[model samples]
Target: MADIESATAQKLLKAFMQFRKTGWHDKKISGHNPSEFKVLATIQQGANEKDYEMKLSEISQRLQVTPPTVTQIINNLEKDGLVERTVDPEDRRAVKIKLTPTGMEATAKARIRFTETFTGLIDYLGEEESEQFADLLTKVQHYFSELNR
Candidate 1:
């Protein structure tokens, strides 16, 4: 039983690693790398949530990256006219980040691409299996979250 469990665990780990590696390879949209797309997506999500804008620190935290890294990315995005930085009205010293019109269009394209990819996965996995996979993943995520606490 221990050997069987070990084999299962190893297979699961291998599958997860491979999935992470390949997941983003073919998902690029509008010539933006995954990191840039992630930042754009995060800001867009915040806006959809009625936040309208986000702080650098908030973006860094959400992306699980350091502030400097996020700042650099945002700077590049700004240069490409994909995002804009403005002074935060509520906090005079802090700045807020928001998507430019170009960013919105790029984000929309990326979102459509993402949806198609996931829908393909659902078709392959079958609806019931997809739901099961999602539930299992959620449970595993919660387990890891608990471990960090």
Candidate 2:
């Protein structure tokens, strides 16, 4: 094999480019758009039935987007009956966002669809090979986390 630096990036970039579309297509069972579903999923992950809520600042940090972008998405979600915003009791200026029943259902369906797709995909690999691939991917994730830190 050529030196690692000599390798072309085209293949890797193309694969990543196709990732979103492929995952979206796989989650077609959800009916909601993939991006909308993602927002709901993110919020649901942070908030639970007991006391689930987060402010725009927290969302912006988690999604790595501007507050405006998060607001736009939330606005659409609120219209679609997927999310709602409440004035924080402790801090009148802060708003807390939470998922609606519809949003939770959509997220659950998308998760199931995604899992099914992933399972279908893993069927192509042998046990040892799949484990090795998972380990490598985990290492890459840790590498990025370290870089961010």
Candidate 3:
């Protein structure tokens, strides 16, 4: 039992390292630097057009950073024309962030490149093995998430 657990940990660590290396993710994905891309991605994920646009507080929470840190990133994104800041209609004290069309385009490109890279690697593994591998990783993640909480 101990040996199996040890092997699982080793396997997960190896896969994480491989992802970090193979991710080859540069900051300059869309003519924007890494920081800019990160800010754009965060806003893109948090924003909902029809509903409430994401608040700066929400961005800070998602990034696990401080409000000031989120503000700095948002400022840069605003300058790049990837995002916009609007006065929150419901909350006079908070501002909402929304993605501009350019931001959407850049985020889409980044998602595509990442998916293509992931698909290329998955293509090398057989179907059953790939399914087994995914299942095992999911179990490992669940285990850690449970322990951490």
Candidate 4:
């Protein structure tokens, strides 16, 4: 049983590595990488929920990245005219982030593409299998998260 479990684990690891190597996530959306798009999506969702510009710390916490890393991405996005940064009026030391018009449009288009890609995956997997796959993935994530704790 131990040998069989070890072999199964090896196969699972290999499958994960191959899936990553396939570059399914490396594809750019609206000239932005997946990480950048994630930031855009987070900010957009935050705006919709709070109706206010998000502080840098909030974004970092939501994305589970360091504040400096979020700042670096924000800098790049700012340079590309997709986002705007402003100093908080109540707290000059704090910076707020908001999407510009261009950013909103880009995010909208990218969102459509994201949906279509997932829709294709669902179609390929069939409805029942796709649901099962999602449940399995959730369980895997939960298992790993508990391991960390």
Q: Identify the candidate with maximal lDDT.
A: 4
State every prediction's TM-score relative to the real structure.
Answer: 0.77, 0.68, 0.65, 0.89
User: 144 in model 4: Cα distance from truth in Å?
Assistant: 2.6
Q: How many residue pairs clash in all the candidates, one count each?
A: 0, 0, 1, 0
Which pairs, if any, clash in model 1? none
Per-residue accuracy of model 4 over 1-149 as CA lDDT, tens digit each: 45636988789888999988999889997688999999999999999998658999999999999999999999999999999999999999999999999999999999999999999999999999999999999999999999999
State which candidate has the highest TM-score.
4
Give the CA lDDT, 0 to 100, for residue 21 in model 3: 85
The digit string of per-residue lDDT tens for model 1 on 22-58 reads 8666566667888898999999998888777899888
Q: For model 2, which pairs clash?
A: none
Q: C-alpha displacement of 121 in model 4, angstroms? A: 0.3
The list of candidate 2 runs beyond 4 A from truth reads 1-29, 137-149
**Regions of candidate 4 where Cα sits further than 4 Å from its true position:** 1-11
Q: Write the per-residue lDDT of candidate 3 for residues 41-148, one digit (tens) a residue.
A: 777776543443688888788778889987988888788787888988788899888888987888889767656756876888867788888999899899899999
TM-score of 2: 0.68
Weakest lDDT window of 10 consecutive positions for candidate 1: 23-32
Which residue pairs collide in model 3, if any? 27-34
Which TM-score value belongs to model 4? 0.89
Ordered list by lDDT, greatest first: 4, 1, 2, 3
Off by over 4 Å in 1: 4-10, 17-27, 143-149
